[model samples]
Target chain A: GPKVLQIPSHQIIDMGQMVTLNCDPVSNHLYFYWYKQILGQQMEFLVNFYNGKVMEKSKLFKDQFSVERPDGSYFTLKIQPTALEDSAVYFCASRSGTNTGQLYFGEGSKLTVL
Target chain B: QQQVRQSPQSLTVWEGETAILNCSYENSAFDYFPWYQQFPGEGPALLIAIRSVSDKKEDGRFTIFFNKREKKLSLHITDSQPGDSATYFCAASGIASSSFSKLVFGQGTSLSVVP
Candidate 1:
């Protein structure tokens, strides 16, 4: 089975600081995605990337957020000027191709902004 | 309206009993429906899935019944155990114009299987 690995399982930062979450997707996966889930809310899509470009992004994706696949080694999500509401569990997932196929998800990076 | 909807915020069942989770969607273009399971402090994992073209799919103790016309689906877990207790999410996705990945997920239902 394929695996997606997320770095810094837990993070705590100041409200105005910047934090970057990293994800290592499966070796052969072509598509990568980011999702966010508040403490007691549903997980919402943030953005999807493929072929070194952003494919699709949801309304929840704010201007403070940016995503990129750097050098085929790490898919990173960087948030500038984090807000209090930004505290949540960020998940990274990868798929071989389309939605019909299975997706591999990382354990998730829990971010808590104070 | 939510693109994907799930019923019963939470459920409790006996260890040996069967548990049924319900889900519905408002998007007609959503042809791929998949269910995911999550434990505390972990990411969601694929549990079972069914396509709009098929009405039913089963794997091990998990089964998915899909109704394309009604845009509804259900996951039935037979012989439930304490280990089956977790938060379950129903997600849907459609073909993107380009190379895109668009996955719409439901609120989620927390199931607690008692021993």
Candidate 2:
């Protein structure tokens, strides 16, 4: 089975600080995605990237949020001047181009903004 | 408006009993439905899925019954075990002209199998 790895399984940061989360998607997976999940709630889609460009994003993707995979390296999500509401478990997912509708997700990085 | 909805926020079943979780969607264009299973401190994993063209899909003791006309689906776990206790999320996505579409998830149903 394909595996997606997320760095810093848990992070505690102060509000208004900048935090960057990294994800190592499955090998040969072209499509990447980021999802946010509050405690005891459903996971919300933040954005999807393909071909080194953002394909689609939801309203939850605030202006402070940015994503990039430089030179096909690790896909990173950066949030500057974070807010308290931004505290949640962020899961990174990737899929192949086969259109199987299956998105392999990582264990998720839990962000706690205090 | 919530495009995907699930009933019974929490459920508890005795071991060896069958547990049924219900799900429905409001989007007609959503042709793909996937059910994800998640345990505490872990990410959700794909358990089973079905397309609009099919009425039923089964794998092992897990089965998905889809009613395309009613825009509803249900996952049935037969002979449930303690290991089956987890939160199940129902997700839907539409494959438009492109091969990629973001999935919309429903408020998950937490299932607890008691021995």
Best by TM-score: 2
Positional deviation of residue A65's Cα in model 2 after best superposition, in angstroms: 0.4
Local accuracy of candidate 1 as per-residue lDDT tens digits, A1-114: 778999989999999999999999998899999999998469899998889988788888899999988788899999998999889999999988643557789999999999
Model 2 C-alpha lDDT per residue in residues B2-35, reported as the tens digit of each score:
9999988999999999999999999999999999
| Per-residue lDDT of A94 in model 1 | 91
Tens digits of per-residue lDDT, candidate 1, B1-115, equal 6999998889999999999999999988888888999999889999887878899999999999999888899999999999999999999887432346477899999999999
Q: How far off is residue A113 in model 1, in Å?
A: 0.6
CA lDDT of B47 in candidate 2?
Answer: 99
**Candidate DockQ scores, in order:** 0.66, 0.77
TM-score of chain B of each: 0.95, 0.97
lDDT of 1 at A40: 46
Give the per-residue lDDT of model 2 (tens digit) for A6-99.
9989999999999999999999999999999999589899999999999999999999999999998999999998999999999999999888
Provide the overall lDDT of each model, using Cα atoms, as 2-decimal numbers: 0.90, 0.95
Share of native interface contacts recovered by each model: 0.70, 0.66
Candidate 2, number of clashes: 0
- The TM-scores, one per candidate, come to 0.96, 0.99
